[model samples]
Target chain A: MAYEKPLPQPTAIDAPYWEYLRQHELRLPRCQECGHIFFPPNKVYCPSCLSDRLEWVKLSGRGKVWSWVVFHQRYFSSFANDIPYVVAFIELEEGPRLMSTLVDCDQGEIRCDMPVEVVYDDITPEFTIPKFRPIR
Target chain B: MAQMTLYDFKDKVCFVGVGDTNYGALYRTKDPRRNQYTLGVEAFKAALDDAGLNKDEIDGLILVRIPSYQLFADMVGLRYLRAANTFRGEGRMSALAVQYAAMLICSGLCSTVAVVYGNDGRSVGATYGGEGEGSSPYDVLYGMTSPGAAVAHMWRRYMHEYGAREEHLAAVATSNRRHAGLNPKAVFRDPLTLETYLTSRYIAAPLRLYDYCLINDGAVALILTGAERARDLRKPPVYLTATATCTDLTFFYTVDDFFRDGVRRCAEAVFGASGLTHKDIQVCQIYDNFTPTVIFGLEGASFCKYGEGFQFVQNGRISLGGELPVNTSGGHTSESYMQGFGLHAENIRQLRGEAGDRQVPNCQVAMYICPAPICAAHIMTRR
Candidate 1:
């Protein structure tokens, strides 16, 4: 069956971020001026200093769960089957946070500061979502 | 040259009249025909009646959620205005309306400005979530669609950080519902105990159904004028001594610091300008879009130390007749959610001592806090 979930359609600025994910690599934009790394990867300039000198750098894909929540309400019809799934804020070792779902972990055992690492969900051939799993 | 301090406009602009739709009566009146304009006009006329002023006296108009200023002004017959504007219906814009009206009045731009808000969200089926709604498309990408989910993430961390439990979150809802029992205008007056709150299914885990605000249709209007003009009005004037706003949009709709910096900055300016500390605040109409927001508001406003918010609400500390009664009108959780419009009205009522049954004894000072990403706070005093 074709993937039936919402996927991030890569724009011109963020196409590289998605392309990197396709190759099982996690990368983000780093400011050459301020050394500030940011997410959503659609920025044309550094958020901190507005410098146009930006470079995409590979990330370690290691982080900790800052916080997590279980969704009991199905806001999207596609997510209705996953009614009680966990979505968490994973604080990367590089000092920025990203939102993703936790996999291979029991809901009852998840802790706030639990160690986690990046895992990819290639739901479709074209798109890959970077999820997190507890680093047991 | 001397600096023009924030205190320069203190007590210069005052709220002379406050009015709202029969929220409880209109609860869940999902008639699409009941639009914002009809509700706005209803509240506007009621405010005019409360102030004993004619429609002709309203020269300036500020609208929220209600789309156009020209249409609202024309419908309400507000001609010869010095200032007229509109703002999106967000929690912060409610207090910003008061700040802008104060600016217009103190700068001699306009007199007797009417700030109005009318939301038919429930009527028009505003889910406030899901695809194509107010949330970012990135939010929907992960099935994290609503504001409640973000707050749930924060509360989960809060619980882990402070060793707080669901009972702490329950304290906020039950206490607000307890106050709602005395509020004839509140929407959810049915008895809600901690047990009910605990067992209620989570919309987003850690935050249950009762933790969220109701999506009801309602309208709120407040009449503002110069202090001199307010004195001649029928009702006692509730002086808007100070107002401030601090925004934290750096984190893409989520705040890593949980709105601590924004609330503190706004609180400092409001407290310094009004010359009233937390102890002097007899009543607080803190925005309760979600129960966690109340915790953040109290903590950020310096009512308690950071991370102590869960405990600060315990054992009737925020109930009526407690050290400081919060959301005496039941707030957005129990009372009808008018975004933040109803909260501003509740503050005026508390300062005017018109909040019967749920009135805090010897109420002299009341504060309104909206602790969103773009947080705002204002202090009102009885004159």
Candidate 2:
């Protein structure tokens, strides 16, 4: 067995979104009334229209590097060996954003607004971590 | 969308009594009862003493991070309690706290309100990451695990966008340390230089140890009463004129404007309400949870043009007697990181001309800006 890092516990509202990730797909809730798309699969209502009507929809899994950070110090023992790894906010084409590990990307080569695509990794049988790769 | 008129609470309510526990006392002490509650009680008693009023006279209370307000109200032996609420210290607490106090007073629901904050965050072994239970949910897997990491991302982006030099970040840390040297209440008063700042190891790239705030323990309390009765207590009055709070449901571009989003909204609301501009501010006590936060706040509050913040503090302009003397008590970097609680206490002291060595002369107006997911702001003026 491999070491497991802390994983997000999907609540009832967000379970379906995680289920989609298990199938190697990225999706979020789109507000049916106001047509607003949002992330984390936990939103219960349209943030703009104040309507609780929403539906799960697949995202294009595309975005630009809105921002990035390289942690020089290990924040957790699970990541002690992974020092100097990149974490970034992916501003998706559909307007929602997700926080994910940026892999297959050099720390020196990372730039703001760089185009990227999502790649999924099964960290554990119970978890599939969604990561990003630079669009070369 | 209609431009809603925020009911003018300008100069309607004023901070009468303010109190702070001795800095670094509990952070350094191993005493059995050096927790937040005891510190809060001490601060509350100090405020009551400063105001020369009985504890029972306070009809309303607002506490941050110190759970169970009913227990506090009971401990104070206040027979008549009219109103009380708790605001999350994790967000724009200090600014929102003063605003809530003023609103409660003006609405006639509470004649006098006590806004109190107590935190032993660092002393209690609370880690500064996603693992911490009291703050924003961090994604540990992605290394978006702590505020330091998140701010590192923002700082790098800011630097890349504006062409900021390493010296620019160093100047902020260097100048704040000099200010801390003058404040007896600051936790770290040792002098810091540009050379030292440059050499400090990085916690997260683009943000060195020098860029981070100290974790310590302390409590701050302020008493708010109608402006009519403010003249009867304490040294001088710091009026709450024009306060605003606006939240961006998500910062990942769902709310546009990147780092400047919240501050811009708060700045518009506050300045729009009052006839005051950024130039009218004599001093500013911005939230310094991270060094870049100060730079972003300056841009958000319209002190300078977008991306001009790095250049604004060039040539020691943010030091005492500079174009703007920011965080005169070293702020969170050199001072205690009581979140933004200390900034409120600093605002009152500056207005009262009691900031000792770091006092900005003619301190007529001051501001505290907490630019976060929840953008909140407060402006204080002396009449």
Q: Which has the greatest DockQ?
A: 1
Number of the top-ranking candidate, with lDDT as the measure: 1
Candidate 1 regions exceeding 4 Å error are B28-32
Q: Write the per-residue lDDT of candidate 1 for residues B214-329, one digit (tens) a residue.
A: 99888998999999998999998989898889988765555767787799999999999988898899988888889999998999999999999988999998999898888888
Docking quality (DockQ) for each candidate: 0.80, 0.59
CAPRI quality band, candidate 1: high
Runs in model 2 lying further than 4 Å from the true structure: A31-35, A44-56, B1-7, B132-138, B251-259
- Candidate 1, after superposition: displacement of residue B311 in Å? 1.2
Itemize residue pairs with steric clashes in candidate 2: none
lDDT score of residue B306 within candidate 2: 89
